[model samples]
Target: MSLSFTSPNKTIFIYDSTKTSEVALLQHVKDQTSKLTEVPINITSVTPQLLNSILTRMEPGTSSLLINKTSPWYRCFCEDFSEMNDFILKKTFVKFPSLIQTPIVIHQDEVYVNPSMKHIFDIYEEIYV
Candidate 1:
């Protein structure tokens, strides 16, 4: 499962809508992008294909980037799974989409997981300025 960006100039925002913080982040993204006249932004929910694409962009042993470590499901998953590999992580994410950390911003082939406000602003600057 991989993602091929048809337009390298576009930005993709992947987030879980159910999460309030993620929702806010989505809105923030919208607000920021609204200032740009031509930069295309694709906002989407966290789906299996998107998750796979995110995981592929991540560095090895960085599964934490994709997971909400504070979630109860994460705690239980940690206890049940002896290892934290891509397969297990993907299964876990698929089973509990809520457990996936979101507000992932993909721009210019760079993936930002749970990026801060500063990072978001920086991304916009990089794109529009």
Candidate 2:
């Protein structure tokens, strides 16, 4: 028999197909959290408004780091917006959500962009303890 657990708080997972590494990271987060914590994660496709909201919560320069420079989508974005000021870059994400990196994890008011295992643990502790 198998045992399962669920979280009381809503966990929003935003992912994109362009980021292969993020996909694996997202899976690892789910598995680790399932085993170590009671946080139930819900995976969802990202939206433009959602991207805008996440960026709004972050510092100007910090949010831009979430852009996946190696992805083909980024190549085109760089070509088009060669010199992206903070405002323009944030606006662009609101227009084209796919241009940003994934998988973003949003737990309540906190948001994690391209989360690591350490990041997941930190958030879990913040919420649970």
- Candidate lDDT values, in order: 0.63, 0.58
Model 2 RMSD in Å is: 7.5
Q: Lowest-lDDT window of 10 residues in candidate 1? A: 35-44
- TM of each candidate vs. truth: 0.74, 0.58
Which numbered prediction scores highest in TM-score against the true structure? 1
Q: Candidate 1 clashing pairs? A: none
Clashes of each: 0, 0
TM-score of structure candidate 1: 0.74
lDDT of 2 by residue, 25-105 (tens): 667666655432221212333444445666665665676667867555677787656578766776776555656666667
Q: Tell me each candidate's RMSD, in Å, in order.
A: 4.5, 7.5
Off by over 4 Å in 1: 34-47, 80-82
Point out where model 2 deviates above 4 Å.
1-8, 17-20, 32-47, 79-87, 94-98, 126-129
Residue 49 in candidate 1, Cα distance off native in Å: 2.6
1-33 per-residue lDDT for model 1 (tens digits): 235643566667666555677677667667756
